[model samples]
Target: MSHSTLKASVIISIYQDVEALHAILYALSRQIEQRFEVIIAEDCECKAVREYLAQHTFPFAINHLTQEDKGFRKTKAVNRAVAAAKTEYLMFLDGDCLPHSQYVAEHLNQRENNRVCTGRRVHLGPTMSRWFRKKPSLIKLIENRLVYTLLGLPLVFDHTKNYEIGFRSTTLHKRQAKKYLTIVGCNWSVSRADMLKINGYNEDLPGVGGEDDDLGWRFNGKGIHEKSVKFVIPVYHLHHVERRADVSTNLQIIKQNTAQKRYYCKNGVDKYLSETHEKLKSNA
Candidate 1:
């Protein structure tokens, strides 16, 4: 599609992190290319989030789609957002993650017909996160990175497995498919049609884990591949407490799905689509 015609819907998954969500939205508002819409895929109905959405006037189209407060229903929330999306392409982001100015533009540039573009994030330390919350600026974040490097803060400067921005990064990443083991749900984009073909996220796996992996595996099973846009589409992940309550169970579900080579998810976007259709018919 041409630049003028290419559009994308960024589905941001959130629970109750209002501050982080605002910060993310601020970052998105400053994107270099603004041919995208924002869909807040809220896992629960938060008054704070709703209030913020009501109060703010964003540069691009914004919609808040929420589900009732359930236990870690990010998969369901995202599937709902997918059903509501109107664009040809979809990008997923977490409320706690902030994207670079060129994030959307890079993702759109890298998009392919049947492939998913995956990116990684730099995890901010507690000190860095606090400072960022106070003054959220991408330019400041870049300055902080330099300061963290000089101060030797391993939490901030550790690039052990992290990808750095360079011309050869994308070329090298494509050659090493095996290296693309994990799909960070926070920074990934796939064509809307391809997502429907694989039936979106697997809601069978409960809680916050392995769902992204299952989607990737299913896409591969359906001959859809992944393109690593790691360094190019940079995102900053705000620090927060880790949740591992349902890690084991989610992993087992992912294993089963992979072993079975399941391409279509039973409990996914279809339910919302049918509901939407019914609502339209009722109104008609």
Candidate 2:
């Protein structure tokens, strides 16, 4: 399909980071390919985010799907967003992470059937995060990678060696081995049909943890392969306090799901899919 016709629903999971959220939305507005919708999967009903969305205007269609502020319900928020998505493809991102100008374009260009694309992000320090929050000139940093390298800021560059944008970088590679272990939820993409086949994310595993890996494992069990877009679709993750308290519990759930080779979760996107459809019908 041509770039113009290729539509994707970009789902961003957010939990109260207004500064970073604004920066991400601004960066997304400047994407090289402006053919995708933005869905804010808010874990809580953040008034600040609501105010910002109501005030600002964006080029693409933007929707907000928020739940109550109930601890860490990232999985539930994302599943709801997926149900409301109205595109052929879906791209997952965190609200704090600013995308490169070519991030969406690269992912859409490298999309394939029965495969999931996994990308990496650069963790910026507090200083750079603050600066970007003030200015939000993401295109400048992305276009001029050498400046960031020369400055040698205290940033953790995760698999960003292949940050160039070209036909060569857009080439998709298959991961025949270890496909399930490396799937990061923050920067990932999958077809809507494939996502439904596995029934979307597992809501049972909650509180900021291994729900992503469990989704990947289930996909792999269903004959789907993982594609690495590591350096090709790099984003800049803003610095923030970590919120992982149930790591062990989440990991144990993933381990059990993997050992059983379960391809579908009992509580997942199916729960909200019908409700979303009904609401849309009512609105119409």
**Sequence-dependent TM-score of model 1:** 0.87
lDDT scores in order: 0.79, 0.79
Give one digit per residue, the lDDT tens place, for model 1 in 1-284.
Answer: 33355488999999988888888888888888988888999989999889988988888888788888868988889998998887889999988888887888988998998888988887776776776676787434463446535544454354322423312245655665445645678899999899999888888887666778788888998888888776567687777788756878988988877778778988888889888777768999
Question: What range of 10 consecutive residues in model 1 has the weakest lDDT sum?
Answer: 159-168
What TM-score would each prediction reach against the true structure?
0.87, 0.88
Pairs clashing within candidate 2: none
Q: Give each prediction's root-mean-square deviation over alpha carbons.
A: 3.5, 3.9
Residue-level lDDT tens digits of model 2 in 4-121: 5648999999988888888888889889999889999999998998998899999888889899987988889999999988888999998888888888888898799999988777
